[model samples]
Target: MSLSFHIGFNGQCKEAFEFYAEYLNGTIGTMLEFKDSPVAASVTPEWQHKIVHANIVIEQVELAGGDVNPEQYQKPQGFNILLGVKSESKVKSLFEKFAIGGEVVLPPQKTFFSPCYAIVVDRFGVPWKFSCGK
Candidate 1:
């Protein structure tokens, strides 16, 4: 079976997905807004334009996310989405890009298991870890 991940955003799914698509060189296969979903009536007027669901494909990996109601929103913690890359330059580039306006937990450096490794939290509050095998 194929495995994938789904993230819950605090009303920033659209923007976050867009950013991820661009930075990761991924393609957005689907982006469904709340106003276009059958559950549109359940969300507040302000959230009508928010994203109900979004999916992107990055190197054959599928990533999905959606906006959650304010009452149900929670800051992401205790986990990180790890990306295994084959290029050191690419890993460093991504580390710099993802660190903008976000917290950098660990700067790019060589580790025992990888040529390069780092951790950063994106502006959308999603934690990410990069491991370069090259």
Candidate 2:
């Protein structure tokens, strides 16, 4: 079985999915909300901004996500979403796209191991690594 990556969005999953879909032409495969699921009874109105679950596919890769109850949205210590690109243009394009309202730890540039590499923490605090094929 192919395993997919999961992201926990405290309350901005829809926004992230929208941005990725728009920029990468990623398809939103399916969605299931907490209020629509059996857990609806347990979800509160305050969690309105958060998404219970959303599946967005970019170039066939599935990025799954949902909101963690605010009272339980724990911070992550480490881990990052790594992206492999085939060209310098792709690196620049993706770096700029995800860097909007986000922090860039390093600008896209050549690294000894790869043609280009960059690191960034998106507005949602999810760290990402971008690299162009050598």
Candidate 3:
């Protein structure tokens, strides 16, 4: 079976996925809003515009996420989304994009295991580990 990760957001799933699509050269597919769901009536009007589900395809890999109920939302922890790229320049560019309004846990630099590597937590509170030239 193929495995895919489903992330939960407080309310920024749409924005985050859009940003990722742009920087990662991905295509966004199947964006559904809370109002579009069968249980739309159960969600508050304020949350109707929130994303219920979104899929972003990067290099044929699908990344999925959705906005969680406000009461149930929690910051992600313990794991990071690791991205393996083929070029150092691409990794640097992507790292810079992820650094906007984000925390840089580790700046891009040469590593023994790779040509370049970096770690950052994006504005959406998603941690990413980027490496290139493996």
Candidate 4:
């Protein structure tokens, strides 16, 4: 079975997915606003425009996310999204792109296990680890 990553955003799901699509060279697969869901009437008018579900496809992997109510939203912790790339340049570029308006946990550097490696938390507060080479 294939695995995918799903994230919860605090009213920024659409913006975050759009950013990921551009930065990761991915395509938006599906986007559904809360207004389009069966529970639309239950959501506040302000939240109707919020994303109910969205998916981004990069290569063969799919990243999914949705907006969560502010009260239920929590800061991400404990784990990070690890992206393995084929080249150092790709890793570096991705790291730089993700670092824009975000925090850089670790700058791109060479390690015994990989040609390039970096850790960053994107503007949406999603932590990512990029590594190049097997």
Candidate 5:
């Protein structure tokens, strides 16, 4: 079986996927909103516009996400999605862009691990690890 990750957000699922597309430069596979599902009428009015399922491809990696249902909501945890960059400037640029209004877990710096590495929890509370090969 092939396993895949599905990212979740409080309410910014759509926005986050869209933002990632910019950096990923990949196509959005599909999106199914609550309003388009067979159970659309069963959802709360406030959640009708929220995405129930969506998919995106970045660097050939398929990334999918959706809003969690209250009955089965599971907050995202553990593993951080990593982006391997090719240069220090790229790592620095991405860190700055996503770190706004978020916490910096590790400042971008040269280390034994690599020439440059940084970790940040983005505005959406999703953690990202950036690094480059020496």
Candidate 6:
């Protein structure tokens, strides 16, 4: 079985996914808003314009995300979306970009398993890990 991750956003699904697609050099295959979905009537008027679902392909991985009601939204914990990059320069660049307006859990550094490794919690509150398995 193939595994994928689905993130829950606090009314920032669209903006977050757009940023991800560009920064990760990924392709967005779907970006359905609540107003365009069948469950439009079930959400509040403000949520109608929010993203109901969005999916992006970063290489072979398909990442999905959606906007949830404020009351149902919670900060992400426990796991991080790890990206195995091939270039050390690329990893450093990504680490800097993600660290802007976000927390840098670990500055890019060489580790036993990878030449470059870093962790950052992005402005959208998503934690990411970057590594170059050289």
Candidate 6: where is the Cα deviation over 4 Å?
A: none
Q: Rate the local accuracy (lDDT) of all candidates.
A: 0.92, 0.81, 0.92, 0.91, 0.84, 0.92
For residues 88-120, could you state the per-residue lDDT of candidate 2 as single tens digits? Answer: 888899889889999999999899988999998
Worst 10 residues of 2 by lDDT: 43-52
For candidate 1, what is the TM-score? 0.95
lDDT of 3: 0.92
Cα deviation of 120, candidate 1, in Å: 0.4
lDDT of 5 by residue, 49-126 (tens): 888888888877888888876666655678898888889999998898888888899989998988999999988778
lDDT accuracy of residue 129 in candidate 5: 93
**Candidate 6, 91: how far from true, in Å?**
0.8
Clashing pairs in 5: none
lDDT of model 3, residue 45? 96
Candidate 6 worst ten-residue window by lDDT: 13-22
Per-residue lDDT value at 116 in model 6: 94
Cα lDDT tens digits, model 6, 1-134, are 98779999989989988888888988999999999999999999988999999999899799999998999999899999999988999899999989998899999999999999999999888999999988
Measured with C-alpha atoms, the lDDT of residue 125 in candidate 4 is 88
TM-score of each: 0.95, 0.90, 0.95, 0.93, 0.89, 0.95
In candidate 6, the residue pairs with backbone N, CA or C atoms under 3 Å apart (3 or more residues apart, or in different chains) clash, namely: none
**Backbone clashes, each candidate:** 0, 0, 0, 0, 0, 0
Better of 4 and 5 by TM-score: 4
Which lDDT tens digits does candidate 1 get at residues 59-94? 999999999998999989989999998888988999
Q: Which parts of model 4 are misplaced by more than 4 Å?
A: none
Clashing pairs in 2: none
Q: Model 2, which residues run further than 4 Å from truth? A: none
